[model samples]
Target: MRKIPKPTLIAKDVFLECISTVGNLLLKQNYEKCQDLVEAAAQDFDNKFPLLEIYQIPRNLTVLGSIGKEEMKSVYTYRMVKDGMPGNTFYNTLKNSAPYGKCPLCSVRFVETLDHYLPKSLYPILSVVPVNLIPSCSSCNTGKKISFPTNSIEQTFHPYYDDIQDESWIKATLLPYDPFGFNYFVECPDSWEQIKKDRANNHFSSFKLNTLFTAHANEEFRGAKDHMKTLFNLHPDELIKHLDGAFRSRRDQLGINSWQAVMYYCLLKDNWFVQGGVLTF
Candidate 1:
């Protein structure tokens, strides 16, 4: 997963805006008790979220609308937190924070929507909290919908907090066949703690990243067939050097474990592949 910069929009400001909008709506609906409860919820939210202990808190249905928790969740999910006037501005800011408008969660698809790091349904108070919102693609958002970690070890890597790109963790192995294929896997450093390794594997599996990368690698290999043939004509020693250069280039452009870098590096290391394995295709 890619590390995303923290959003510039202040969380308190966004929370206040949401409260104001929702408060006005509640007043119009003649739910003064609910409006007062919302104010209390706002204070509780600030303590939980801004203080960074939100995960420990449980969903309090009592503070929600008089209509009930389900209705309150719907109002926040659809109206107040996602589609309302302030929400539009909030969503845009989070989306713009993504580098090159790409989803930070997978570093693949374009940023299409904001995902609640903590699902808004479970933590309605955090529905509009800037720190709780993440810019994401539809796939990542849907795959991760409403799933929160039960423990610290189970927590998926947060782009705002985790930056695993500094190391090479993802790896691939070539399948020598006519239509050469690859398999991607998480191979975390031996120095990493067991918890980190588990989390990395969890992130990869949860997003089905291995399947996605394998498909991409196959497509990339198809396009590089002619180039590989041309490189094979060069001295085998030079071919290794060229492949290493390509690996480095991809690593520099993307991260160390980017699919291209991993693919090229693995190919360069495989004696059969560097010599004549690719020619079979």
Candidate 2:
């Protein structure tokens, strides 16, 4: 949903920082032994990340010695996230990297944790990889997560890699029914490849952006109902003008596909809504 700068730190630096704080001698030695494989995997991740070729990298049962999936995952949970650990600095840095401190996935919720772009349970080698982690809200992080993308269309957008902010895709249509609310969707550019469009669509549905936006939009409309009624009573044109200005502001400040802008656009264009239809639910 939003593009964020990739972390300047690479895999080896973060790995070394974490391994330095480990008190277990044999475990530390084993982690050190795995460093070569970790760095190589990290390089493969960096190379294949943008292309959805990450599935090309191999997955194994363990990192090295007894450092299996959950153990590798704990390197993140204990060393990286736990307080006073040497690697906690990198953890906080990555967690704080969210743009304006908002979860890039939903853009509404404040970031609460760093989510593994690829689950650590499956890809243990990438458990501590920087690029594999994304700052996200608890809700977004817990929802149905990503797995291997067998093809281009199934791949979700990586905020650090994918930037769709330049174009408007998010759209809302007046339901004009008993609910009398708007439904959210995307209208991606025709110039984009079919696979690109599919990926955008997948990101929207996978994150449940439509449901999130609609719920918030209803709250906003309810709070602004009195103002809308007043504007409509004064003049229908005044209502449209207010919405027009609001849409422009939201579009300028947020991206054009932002729910607020599209919601305003939908309302302003609806004849029923402007001509005293503002009173309806």
Candidate 3:
């Protein structure tokens, strides 16, 4: 997962407004109530976010409860896509959440979709909750996490709230010379293990991050066959230097504004700084 740029409260409100309008259009049973429901959802989503202004609405009543099929069937896409505002904004927002638009599940760069953390199939009403929606690569979206809740909130990483830009987000163990070449198994810390196991397994297996690509990169970085070889053989200073350089090198290589690039860099920085590396600036 990448480090997503937090959208301004106003921008989020804008998105909410659009969603409400669509909702109102679909559920036209009561015009006045539909207006109120839109207002309430905006307030609710805003109140949850600190450092953001709570947008005021005309009245406090909530009338509309769900998105009507009419709205869903309506075609809406953004500038980059053929459809127009709602579709485009949704796509761009999810794209921003991904690591260079790569799937978090498979790490593959392919056409992705907006995934509902709480599966929309089960809870269709939550389909538009901005916080509930995530950009996922095709394989993970279609093949793995469809409608499944692997763990509790405490055990899993919430893309909106959890900061994944640290080594602690995942613990990697290099495997011994293995036959399958399935090099490493990533686990959360022992303290977090029992509770997080299911979530971790889901994350690793679904995204395939524990596979060949990540392992190869890990080996290339340590100049070893696996993480243990790098850890046991390398000096602390040597580790610091390499990790530091790698982090710095990525900032320019991945393109600064890209959220995934920023996250990968932050993880590198945190890894070395924890080991006594000084911050120059």
For each of the candidates, the C-alpha root-mean-square deviation to the true structure, in angstroms, is: 3.7, 1.6, 9.8
Best by lDDT: 2
**Superposed model 2: Cα runs more than 4 Å off:** 279-281
TM-scores vs. true structure, each candidate: 0.83, 0.94, 0.52
lDDT (10s digit) by residue, model 3, range 23-131: 4444434333444443455446445433222112122222244444333223222222234554466556655667666554344455467665554444332334455
Q: What's model 2's overall lDDT?
A: 0.84
What are the per-residue Cα lDDT tens digits for candidate 2 across 181-272?
66999789989888788888988988899999999887788788799888888988888899999999998887777788888988988888
**Winner on lDDT (1 vs 3):** 1
List of clashing residue pairs for candidate 2: none
Rank ordering of all candidates by lDDT, starting from the highest: 2, 1, 3
Residue-level error in angstroms, candidate 1, position 178: 4.7
Q: List the candidate 3 regions with Cα displacement exceeding 4 Å.
A: 9-82, 97-99, 104-111, 150-155, 169-180, 190-198, 211-281
TM-score, candidate number 1: 0.83
lDDT, each prediction: 0.72, 0.84, 0.44
Clashing pairs in 3: 77-83, 77-84, 78-84, 78-88, 105-207, 106-207
